[model samples]
Target: MNIVVVSDHAGFTLKEDIKTFLESENHNVIDCGTYSKESCDYPDYANAAALAILDGKAERGIFICGTGIGISIAANRHKGIRAALCSDIYSVRLSRQHNNANVLAMGANIVAIPLAKEMIKEWLKEEFEGGRHERRICKLDID
Candidate 1:
């Protein structure tokens, strides 16, 4: 999978760790950065990652922030971007299976690296049900 990942200063370390882990799992990752732990805005990175998905540069995205809330909100502003903020395996699976989410957002402060890895694994494994769920996801594009 070709995945784009972005993070602010607060999530730099976690983002780097996740990037390495994803790479090891054979995912081609585009690292959209804050670069180091210097203070920086989350929206900039969030928008860049979201644009990668919108522009077809990446198949999926993983965005990180202190709480993941702000970044997810920003990504969701793009039409067709279903950015789901998930901290658990069940939510991660449902996000893909039901929402057909193209993006996953996680809080560096809220989830540990191991748990986040498991959540990502589960998310990648689940396929969208696309029956009644497809009807609901279609509603998300309404103006």
Candidate 2:
């Protein structure tokens, strides 16, 4: 999968680690970054990654920040992006399965690297079960 990843200063280290892991797993990764630990706005990176996904340049996106909440909010401002803040494997899977989310958001401070990796793996493995859920997702797009 081609994935776009973006992070603020708070998530820089974790994002770098995830990017390496994603590449090792043979997924194409586009790192939109804060680059260094120097201060930067989370919304800037979030919007960029969201646009990449919305424009069909990426299959999905993973956004990271201190709490994940701010970046998720910013990414979701784009009409076509359903950015879900997931803290566990279940939420990650369900975000794709039920919400058909194209963007995943994680908090660098809330989860360890290994746990985040596991969550990402599960999320990537799950496909959206678009039977009954399709109607709801359609409503989401309209609203």
Candidate 3:
């Protein structure tokens, strides 16, 4: 699968680790900036990831920031983007299974590396259970 990932300075190191991990899993990844640990706006990276998914350049997106809240909020501003901020395995699984989330957001500071890896693995593999959830997701598009 093709995945797009983006992060602000607070998430820069974690983002690099995630990119390497994804590549090792044989997924094609597009890494959007902040390339360095220098301070940068989270919205810029969030928009890049969201637009990539909207344009079909990637099947899914991963966003990271200090708290994950800001980045997810930015991504969710896009009509078609359902960006879920998940910190646990169950939340990650449910985000995809129940929410049909195309974007997964994680807090670089809130989650440990091992747990984040597991969360990402679950987020990537779980299939969306579109039943009643489909109607709710559809409602999200009714703007």
Candidate number of the best lDDT:
3
TM-score of each: 0.97, 0.97, 0.98
**Please, what are the lDDT tens digits per residue for candidate 3 over residues 5-118?**
999999998999999999999999998788999999999889988999999999999999999999999999999999999999989989999999999999999988888889
lDDT of candidate 2 over 1-143, digit per residue (tens) = 89999999999999999999999999999988879999999999998898888788899999999989999999988899999999998899899999999999999999899999999999899999999999998887665
Instruction: Encode model 1's per-residue lDDT on 71-126: one tens digit a residue.
Output: 99989999989999999998999999999999999999999999999999998888
Q: Candidate 1, residue 50: CA error in Å?
A: 0.6
Predictions: Cα RMSD each: 0.7, 0.9, 0.6
Descending-TM-score candidate ranking: 3, 1, 2
TM-score of 2: 0.97
Clashing pairs in 3: none
RMSD of candidate 3 to the truth, in angstroms, is 0.6
Give the candidate number with the greatest TM-score: 3
Show model 2 residue runs off by greater than 4 Å: none
Count residue pairs with overlapping backbones in model 2: 0
Model 1, residue 129: displacement in angstroms? 0.5
Query: On a 0 to 100 scale, what is the lDDT of residue 77 in model 2?
Result: 88
